[model samples]
Target chain A: SQELEQSPQSLIVQEGKNLTINCTSSKTLYGLYWYKQKYGEGLIFLMMLQKGGEEKSHEKITAKLDEKKQQSSLHITASQPSHAGIYLCGADRSASKIIFGSGTRLSIRP
Target chain B: GAGVSQSPSNKVTEKGKDVELRCDPISGHTALYWYRQRLGQGLEFLIYFQGNSAPDKSGLPSDRFSAERTGESVSTLTIQRTQQEDSAVYLCASSPVGTDTQYFGPGTRLTVL
Candidate 1:
C-alpha cells in the first residue's frame, strides 16, 4: 500500500510571514492533490498535479510536484488568518482510491 | 452546479446498532467514493463505485461495513454492529467518468456510544 507523509505536523506563523508544507510519498506518485479543511468542516479542493516538475498556483498559494514525482510542496505567501486550517495531501493509489497524509495543522497569528 | 451533498450531518448511535449514511453525488458524475476520517487523522478510503461495474471493496475495514450506489446518483454506506471505533466522519466524493479529481461532501459525523 502507498502512504503519504507530511512534514511539520503543526505550524504557527505570523500573519504576514510565508510558510511551506511538504508531502512525501513512499511510492512514485501518479496524481497528487491538495485540500484544505477548516476545523470540522468538509475539505475544499486546492489543486492537483499529475506530471512531474509541474507547478500550479491559486491566489497566494502555490503547489509544485518534484521531478521524481514522489514529493510535493505547498507554499503560502504572506499568509492570512484565512489560511489557518488543516492541509492534507492525497495520492492516487489507483484509478478510484486516494490515500491521504496525516495532514499539517496550520495556524496564523494576527 | 451543486457539489456532492450528504444527509444527517451528524449521527449518534449505540454500540451493536446499525446506521446508514446517505450521499448524493453531483449530477452526471459516474464515480462515487466513501471515506472515514477519525479525530485528528486523515481520510481513509472505504469503498468506490464506478457506473455499473462492481464496486471496489478492498478498502472496507471489515465485513460490517458495506455501501451501495444506485446507478450513478446516490450512495448509502451502512455500518452493522457498530463499535466505538466506528465513530468518525463519513465523507463522500464524486467525479466525472474520465477524471480523478473528486469533489467532497460536508460529511456525516457518526458517534457510537
Candidate 2:
C-alpha cells in the first residue's frame, strides 16, 4: 500500500565518498521534498522540487526531479561523517497531504 | 525565535486510557498537518487543518482518533481509548499558504502499555 519507494534501504560509505539515493513513486508527484533526521530527532528540511526537471542543492546535498515527475534522486558530494542519518523523501500531491518513503539509513565511517 | 512546537515530548500511558497531544504552529502559518511514524516505517499522514474551515481527517485510522485545531493556531490530537497498537512518534508540521516547505516540530513519542 506504500506509494513512495526508496532504494538501498540502508547505506554505508567512507568519509569523502559520494552516495546517491533514489525515490520512485507509483503516482505522479506534485511536490517532492527531501529531509534529514538524526536518530530520535525531528526532521530537517533539505530541499523541495515542485516542477518536473527541476533540481536544487543545499550544502553538500543536491536533489533532482526527473522530467517524468515520478522519480527523484538525492546525491551527496564528498560525504562527511556528519551527513550520516536517515534520509526521507516525501511526495505531496497537494499542500494538504504528503506521503513519505521508508527512509534511507546512511552511515559514514571515517 | 519561533517554530512549530509540540508538548509532552514523551508520553507513556496504559491501554484504554485517552491521551491528548498538542501542537502550536508558528505565527501566521495557515496550513498544519499531523503525521505518525512507527518504528521501522515511513511517516503516515494523519490529518490536516487549513484555516479552520474543516479539517481533512481522511488519514485517521479509526473512529478512536480525532483532532481539532483552534482559531488556526494550535492543534490537539486526541485518541480515545488508546490501544497497544497506537504507539508511534506523532509529528506536527506547519506551512504558510501555498508553500511547499513545511517546518516540523519535534514529535511526541507515545507508548501504550
Candidate 3:
C-alpha cells in the first residue's frame, strides 16, 4: 500500500472559491510537507509541518496538521488562476526518505 | 550559483540502451537526492547521497538504476538495458544539512521507445 494517500485526484473550482486538499498517512508522520508543481516543471516547496497541531499559511494558502500527525490539509481561500497546479503532500519518517502522495491536480477557472 | 541544474533537459532512447542523467546541486549543499515521476504517478524516491557516502539505496527499484556522487557536487544516475517502463521525468534535489526544505532541478525528461 502507498504510505501516503490524497483525496480527490483532480478538482476544478471557479475563481474566488475556497478549496481544501487532504493528505493521510498509513503511519505516523514525523514531518509533513506540501509542494506545488506546475506542468512539466519541478516541485516548489510550499510549507513544512513537523509538529502535530501545527498550522502555517502562505498568502491565500493555509496548511494544518492534525494533533495525531496522521493527516494534513492544504486550504486555499479565494482561489486564483495562479493556484492551478498539482498539489503534493509528503511525509518523512525517522531516518527514512520522503514519500509523496499521487498528487491532487487543481484547476482554478477564471 | 542559483539553484539545482540538470543537463540534457530531455532524452529519447530505444530499448536495451544505456542512459546517463546528470545533476548539479547547489553550491555547499551536502545532501543530494534522485527521484523519478512517471506520468500520472507520484514521485518515487530512487537514491540519496549525503556528502561522499550514500546511507540509503533502498529506494532504487532495481540494479539497472545506479547513482554516484563525487564529494557533494555533481551526481549521475545511470540506467542500463533500459525498458519502456523506465520512461519518466527524473528529478534531482538538494538541501542544506538538517534542513527539511529541498530545492529541485528542472528535471530531465526521459522517453524510451
The residue pairs that clash in candidate 1, if any, are: none
Residues B1-113 of candidate 3 have per-residue lDDT tens digits of 69899987889999999999999999988888888867544567787777766446777899999998999889999999999999988888887775434677778888999
Q: Candidates' TM-scores?
A: 0.55, 0.55, 0.55
> By lDDT, who's the top model here?
1
Give lDDT: candidate 2, residue A13. 97
Interface root-mean-square deviation for each candidate?
12.8, 12.6, 12.5
| Candidate 1, residue A86: how far the Cα is off, in Å | 18
Q: Candidate 1 residues A1-110, lDDT tens each?
A: 32889988899999999999999987899778888866323466788888899999999999999999999999999999999988989876653345678788899999
Query: B1-113, model 2: which lDDT tens digit per residue?
Result: 69888988889999999999999999998888888866544566788787866887888899999999988789999999999889988889887775544677778889999
CAPRI grade, predicted model 2: incorrect
Clashes of 1: 0
Q: A55, model 3: CA deviation in Å?
A: 21
- Give the per-residue lDDT digits (tens) of candidate 2, residues A1-110: 56889988899999999999999998888778788866423466688888899999888999999998999999999999899988889865443345678778899989
